[model samples]
Target: MKKSLLIIALAISIISCNKETQTTEAAAFKTAYIDTSKLMEEYTEAKDVAAKYKSKSDEAARKLEVQEANFKSDANYFQKNAQANGQAWAQQKGAELQQRQQQLQYAAQTMAQQLQEGHAVEMDTLVKSVKKFIKDYGKEKGYDYVYGTGDAASVLYAKDSYDITDEVVKLLNDKYTTSAKKEETTETKKEEKK
Candidate 1:
């Protein structure tokens, strides 16, 4: 009876140890990280957005440049004819030129402010979209933690095997391309219907 009791106790202890090992294995977390800078650099949507904004900025600058050139020309002409045009005429023209300058300055400031606001909003949306994508990706891939590494590195060290930047970039670009193609096809169908 004593030997039998000891054997039963040993069996119970072994079963408990097996259960703990299984629990430990199941509790292990899967972690990965992405290089944010590389992701942004390689992301087609990001590149396209950047180019679009740059074009808008360039167009605004060109319009402002033309206006400035015209203003400068008028100012030069007024200066050359100030004495010939008489004191009253000179004073009036000077005031007009000053007002025009002020208008130009206001226009420049407004354009800059508008562009900055628009770009900031667009960038914010893009960032949020990327973050959501990453979160969804982690969930889909059974990852418990997904870290971002950039100029401001949140992760101190990680193995290269854990870097998913390239994979994420490829998936993002593929999705962007597919969506773009769908949009183009939809537009073409609309045009045909019209």
Candidate 2:
């Protein structure tokens, strides 16, 4: 009777232990990480944003360059004719050139600041979009945690198998392409209507 009771108790404990193990396994958290630098580099939307800003910067630079060239030409003309134009005229013209220079400088500074602010706003929007996308992806994929690794890496090390950067980038690009196509189609339809 004693041996049988001992056997029954052992069996009960074994069953309980097995049940606990199974529960623990089932409750294990699923985690993954992304290489943000790679994601940004590969993401089509990010690249497009960068290209758009670059184009804007280039255009602004070209405008400034033209203005600068004109200013230089005017200054050269003034210098060449300063003495021949007489002291009073030279001083007046010199003041005018100085005013022009100040205006040019102000314009350049304003343009640069506007571009910088616009770029910053766009980048902030892009980052927020990406973060929200990642959050939604994590929930959809049953990921308990999705860490980021980049210039300001939150994750120090993760196995390559656990990296989802490529997957995220691919999905983001596909979404962007689909949206872009839809926009183009909508525009084309509007144009046709016209």
Candidate 3:
């Protein structure tokens, strides 16, 4: 009876110890968070993409300005000559001006739509790229969870030690620079071959 009781006690202690170790392991699971706003601001690829779109937007704006000037010129000409041209001629010129105005409006709308769509697509790609990099970084570093905190930070507070924003930004920028270099090299090689 005594031997059986001792064995049961020993088994119980071992089971308890195992459970305690499991809890400790669970507590040790690594987690970190990144400042997403900082990441976006510092990420080279994101800046490059923004600059690219800004140039496109600027070009569109210039085209619209030119169109606007032309439309204004046409309107001024019609205003000056409408009285001398007679009702029939003035009506035809007014109709032509109206059509040109509509065409300019349509062109402006189309450019705006294209710019919006391009921005959406570029932003989407940038978001995906950032997410993928973070995911891979977390996995590589054995992180159980890598949280993101930004303007609308879900994480109220976190230890500075847990913030990996700088590391992530550096990694992303280095990758961008390396890829850009490779592209330039390829272009040079192609030019040499030509």
Candidate 4:
């Protein structure tokens, strides 16, 4: 009888220990997604500026294309009329045309380089801001691991329910809003003091 009781006690102890461990693990861990795309879209000023620069560059390219077409038409007209007028005048005009083309090319190249440089600067600044936010978020929230989709090897196929993108955005908006309110109050106090 005592032997049977001992076996049952040992089994209960093992089962209870396992249950405790499982409970502790369950309480300690959770999986979630940050949906970085949403955050970048929402808070990224650099991305916005880069987009503007790209639009401007595209516009400049289109304008240059129109100018090139006009130049081609003018060149054709000049070539057709060159036989009637002195080749000297046409030659002079051709040299002038070449100068104009060189100037346009230089301008286009400069604008393109400007766009590229601006985009690089904006992206670098954005990356720094995002990294700082993520680092602070991890520290503030006690996240064991905060992974981004940029890591293609992992973090694939997370369900929408597990995503905390909206939550994080909302939290940030609230924090900023509250800070703005506090600043406004401080400004009002200063005005009163004055």
The Cα local distance difference test for each model comes to 0.95, 0.94, 0.94, 0.77
Give the alpha carbon lDDT tens digit for every residue of 107-168 in model 4: 78997888888788878876786677777887778776666663343587777776777776
User: Which residue ranges in model 2 land beyond 4 Å of their true spot?
Assistant: 1-27
In model 3, which range of ten residues has the least summed lDDT? 147-156
Instruction: Write candidate 1's Cα lDDT for 64-164 as tens digits.
Output: 99999999999999999999989999999999999999999999999989989998898889889889999999999999999999986899899999999
Evaluation by TM-score, superior candidate among 2 and 4: 2
Lowest summed lDDT over 10 consecutive residues: which window, candidate 4?
145-154
Worst 10 residues of 1 by lDDT: 22-31
TM-score of 3: 0.87
Question: What TM-score would every model get versus the actual structure?
Answer: 0.86, 0.87, 0.87, 0.62
TM-score, prediction 1: 0.86
lDDT by residue (tens digit), candidate 3, 79-183: 999999999999999999999999999998999899899988998998998899899999999999998899868898999999999999999999999999999
- In model 1, residue pairs whose N, Cα or C atoms come closer than 3 Å (at least 3 residues apart or on different chains), thus clashing, are none
Ranking by TM-score: 2, 3, 1, 4
Instruction: Give the lDDT of residue 158 in candidate 4.
Output: 76
Model 2 deviation from the true structure expressed as Cα RMSD, one decimal place: 4.6
* Model 2 weakest 10-residue run by lDDT: 22-31
